[model samples]
Target: MFERFTEEARRVVVGAGRESAELRHGHIGTEHLLLAILAETEDPAARVLIEAGLDRAAAREAVRRLLGEGDDARALAAIGVDLDAVREAVESVFGAGALDAPSKEEPRRRGWFRSEGRAGRSPFTARGKKVLELSLRESLRLKSGHIAVGHLLLGLLREGDGLGARVIADHGLDFAAVRRAVEVTTG
Candidate 1:
């Protein structure tokens, strides 16, 4: 299946891994894949998303908020919880990055001399893998011989339930409209 991926599509996958690492996330998720698509500035999919008002920074912040990263403090505040104060107290007692500790769910890979429990090295989450599979379906649906970045957008939009889709929705962009635009622009 991977052999059918165009170079640009492969780059998007690699970029998704990079994004997961950057966020210290345990597994590759649809949010990371969306970030990769936005990063590929030369792709027609990215151009269409940009023109539709999906800013990368805003999307990244949305991802963080959804994932309960440090941005969760704001959400906590809304409920009268002082997450910042709690984090500071916890960190002072447990040392820094205590709240950012890697989850046990992250698989440990045997390196040459040690185990690597890093984020990007982990496998994709189920939803993430489904999005890739959906991309293949989208390509075949479009009569495309190989998977392309545009097909990925179609898949993400079709999934319509992952954080990637949520971020798109948060941007006030209509999924059907974006999907049609992608097909029209990249077809």
Candidate 2:
């Protein structure tokens, strides 16, 4: 699953895992991934949340609540989320093969270490590649050097309307604000 991420995106996952482990006193899970996506300082995802009114304190509170911790433990516990569900959610959000199985049109390819005949700059993982593609699109649109975290955030914001975007919007963040913030930061 980790194999499907770009270097930076992989790092984001790793960082999220570490955070989740710290949160649960166990191992990684989807909650962690969601938190990681929300916490990704260098990625645009984080920026989008920020622009949308997901203040750091509020985000932390939401994460804590989602994890069934803090003073609202009973309320969170009542929601009831098992490890498997957590794992599946993580996979779904991260595109780590939890759901949305890859199709034959884009068969799963081997990574640099596994591929026997490749000798070029290793390609990004599926998630990373997607993020990069989004970044590139943003870059081309904005005409800038490489991709920035803000561009990545804009990309995620633009991704087919889904939970992530819904969550962001719930907090009052609009795509335009996110794009403006990215442009300002990049500029």
Pick the lDDT winner.
1
lDDT of 2 by residue, 71-179 (tens): 3334555788455466667887886644322333434575422322222112233443354356568766877655544555555565625333444565666667776
The sequence of per-residue lDDT tens digits that candidate 1 reaches over residues 6-88 is: 89989988888767765656677899899999988888888888888786777888998889543455567789998658878
How many pairs collide in each candidate, listed in order? 0, 2
lDDT of 2 at 169: 60
Tell me how far candidate 1 lies from the true structure as C-alpha RMSD in angstroms: 7.3
Error of 1 at 120 (Å): 4.9
Model 1, residue 119: displacement in angstroms?
A: 8.1
C-alpha lDDT values of all predictions: 0.80, 0.51
For every model shown, what is its TM-score relative to the native structure?
Answer: 0.73, 0.45
CA lDDT for candidate 1: 0.80
Off by over 4 Å in 1: 70-120
Off by over 4 Å in 2: 1-13, 16-34, 37-48, 56-132
Error of 2 at 103 (Å): 28
